[model samples]
Target chain A: MNPSARQPVRATTSINGMIITVASGKGGTGKTMVAASLALSLAAAYPQQPPLYLDCDVEAPNAHLFLHPTLAEQQEVGLLIPAVDEAKCTHCGKCAEICQYHAIAVLGKKTLVFPQLCHGCGSCTALCPEGAITEVLDRMGIVERGSAAAGIAFARGVLDVGEPMAVPVIRQLKKWALPRPGQVVIRDAPPGTSCPVVETIRGSDYLLLVTEPTPFGLHDLRLAAQVAKELNIPTGVIVNRENGTYPEIDAFCEADHLPILLRIPFERAIAEGVARGKTLVDIHPEYGDRFRQMFLQIYETISHS
Target chain B: MKILLTATSPSIDSNVDPRYGRGAYFIVVDPDTMEWQAHPNPGIGASGGAGSLAAQFASNQQASSVVSGDFGPNAYNALQAAGIAMYLFGSSATVKEAIENFKAGLLESVGAPTGPGHHQH
Candidate 1:
C-alpha cells in the first residue's frame, strides 16, 4: 500500500457543513500538519466554498505558521472574575465557604482573591450576602481571523502566558469562527486528552487522531480513544511515521474496530520539509488528492452512521 | 504569645510537617502555659490556593507566629498582611521540640517566601 498513489475522484456530493477535528493524545505527533494540509486540500477541491480552519490549541498555537493567514480581525477573550468592594463588605466568610476551587479566602477583616486559580464560575459574586462582590473582565487571551492559501478561512486562539485555563479561549475561537452553510470546518486540536482537548473535539462530526509508532504514543492513544468512546463520537486513526516495526498500534486499532484512514511513513525528506515549515502537500503535491479522497471516505462513513 | 505549628498529627509528639500549605494538622499552642488545641488543616486536599486558605485559618486562630519548614508565596504574603511572624523549623523536630525552640530563640525568622507557590511548575 502506497499512500501516495493518486486516484482522482469527482467532487459530486455536497458535504453540507461538517466539522472535522484533528487531534492526538501525545505531543509532536503531526496533528497540525495533517489538519492544515487537509484544510488546504478541501479548500482547493471546493473553491466556491472554502473550508474553515480553526486552531484550537490556545496554549501553544502554531498552525498559523503553516497556514500563513493574513489576520484581518482580532478580539480579546476574557473571563468574569470576582472583585470585592471593601466599603460595603462584611467578613461573613460565606464566599470562602461556597468556593470549590479555593480561589477566595476571608480572614478576620481581609478578603483575598487569587485570579489565577479562579474558574470564572461567578459563584462568589452571586452568593455574596452583603452584595460586595462584583464581576470583572479578566483578559485571558485573543482570537484572530484571517484568510490563508487557496482562500482557506483561518482563525486561531492564543492564550496568555502562564494562564492555567484554555477552555474559555478555545470556546471563544469556535464562536468567532463559526462555519457557514455547506462549508466544512477543520479544527487543529492541542495534544493530550485533558480538558482543553475535550473542549476542542466536542460537537464535532468526525475525529481524526494522529499517532506515532512508539510505546509513548501507544500509551496516550489508548487514553485518547477512551475519551472518544466516552463522547460517543465517530473516530479514525492516522499513523504517522509508519515504520512497520510497531504492530501494537495496528493490533489496538483492529481490536477497537477503528479504521486506519492514512499512513505517513518515516522518511527523511518529509521530516526535513516539515522542519522547514512546509506542509505535507507542499512537499508532495500528490497528498492534496489523497486528502480529498480521505475526506470523501470520512463523509461516507458519517452519512451512513 | 500564641503560635501555630504544622504537624503530622494532633499530638505534640508528632513530627513537624515540612509543607505549610498542604500540611496535615495545624496546632495552636502557648509556650508559657503549654496549652494547645489541634485542628485538621482544611487545605490538605485543595486543588489550588491552599497556601492562602491555610494562612486564613492561622489568622482566624489569632496566632502571632507560624512555625513551618517552608512558606509558599501566598501563605507568606497573607501571614505578613495579618501581622504574623514566620519561623523556620527542622523537618525532623517534634511539635513540642519546635515550641521549645521557638521560646529559646533557636528557630530562624523568615524574611521572604521560602518557596515558589505550588501552582507554579
Candidate 2:
C-alpha cells in the first residue's frame, strides 16, 4: 500500500525514547536508503505509534522519493543577517572590519552589502559603533511535515541553492519535530565528517554508521568513528555490500570493537531498485524484516548501555 | 587627492605588495606632497572577506585611488562603488614609482577584479 494513502501518524504519543541517527563517513554508502527502510519497517511493526523520519541532509534530501510522504504542512526557514541604516551613517568601516565573511564593504560613503556571502553571525551588527546595522531575516530553506504509511511522521529540510550553511535548517527541523518518549526517531544525516553531520547526530542516543568494505570506505569510516567517539555517542556499523573478502573494514571494526549491526550483500537488484527510487525493502519485503531485526539490536544496545 | 598604495615596507622605496586584500601594508600618500603613512593590513590573516575589508580601509583613509597588483571581486566592487579608481601596479614597481605613475596617468586602471578571491591561500 502507498504510504500517503494512510491516515495521519501520531508522532508524539509515546515517551522519552532513543533518537537513532543514521550517518555515513562517505557519500553514496546507502545512508538514505537504510534510514528510510528502517523507518518504514519500524512504522510497520508499530502501526498505532509510528516513527519519525527526519531527512537531515538538507543539501540533497532524497529520502522522500522512497517514502512518498504527503506533505500537509510547510514552513520557511531563515537566518538573521544584518541590514544597514545608511541615513544616520558615518563611513566608520567598522562593520566591514567586524564581518569575517566580508559581507559588508565600506568604500568612503559607499557601503556595499553582499547578502550571499553573509554567514548571518551578527558580528557586523553587534560591533557596529554607529548602530547602523540591524538584524534581518533571510530565507534559507523550507521544512515540510507529512505522514507516510505505517504511521511514520516525516520531516525533511531542503536548503536553498547556493546556500553553504545547513545547520540552521537542521536545527529548525529538530526543534519542530521533538522526540516523544518510547517513540523512535530516525535521522538520515548528511555524509562526511563535517559540521553538518556532527550537528545532526550530536544529541542522538545511537549512531548507525554505514560503510562499505573498501580502502576509501574504511578510511572515511575511521574518521566517522572518531567523530562518534568524540561526541560520546554509542555507534555501530552497517556495512553495505558486505559479501566480500575485503578484510580491511572488518579488521578495523573488530579492532575498534564496533558491532556490525546488519549487512546487505552485493546485489545488483538492490542497486537497480534504489536507482528507480524504490528502496530495497520496497522491492524486497524480506529486507524490511532484516531492518526491523537490526532496529531491535540497536534498541537492545541503547537500552543496555 | 590621497592615493593608497599597497607596500611591503614602511617607506616608498619598498616594492609594491602584489596582493590586494592580503597585502602586508597599505600606504596612503598625497602624490603632490609625498606625505604618507603605512598601516598594517588587518585583512592579511582573515579567513575570508579580506578584499572588502581592504577596500573599506582605502575609503576610511580618504584615498581617492588605490594601486595594487591584484584585486579580488569583492574589493573591486567595494572600491568601484565608493567611486575610488583602482590602478594596477606590478611587483617591480616601488611605492614611490606607483605614486609617480598615478600622478603621471601612466598606471593601468582596473575595472574588474584580476582573479578569484582567496587564491593566495
Please count the clashing residue pairs in each candidate, in the order shown.
Answer: 0, 5
Misplaced by over 4 Å in model 2 are: A1-16, A93-101, A121-131, A243-245, B1-19, B22-40, B67-73, B87-108, B112-121
Candidate 2: tens digits of C-alpha lDDT, residues A192-295? 99878999998898999999988888999999999999999989999998878788888899999899988888889888999999887787899888887787
Please list the residue runs of candidate 1 whose C-alpha ends up more than 4 Å from where it truly belongs after superposition. A1-13
Listed models, DockQ each: 0.50, 0.47
Which numbered prediction scores highest in lDDT against the true structure?
1
Per-model lDDT:
0.89, 0.83
- Candidate 1 residue-wise lDDT, B44-81, digit = tens: 98878889889889888989999999998888888887
Using TM-score as the measure, which candidate wins?
1
* Residue A300 C-alpha lDDT in model 2: 59
- Hey, what RMSD does candidate 2 come out at? 6.0
Recovery fraction of native interface contacts for candidate 2: 0.77
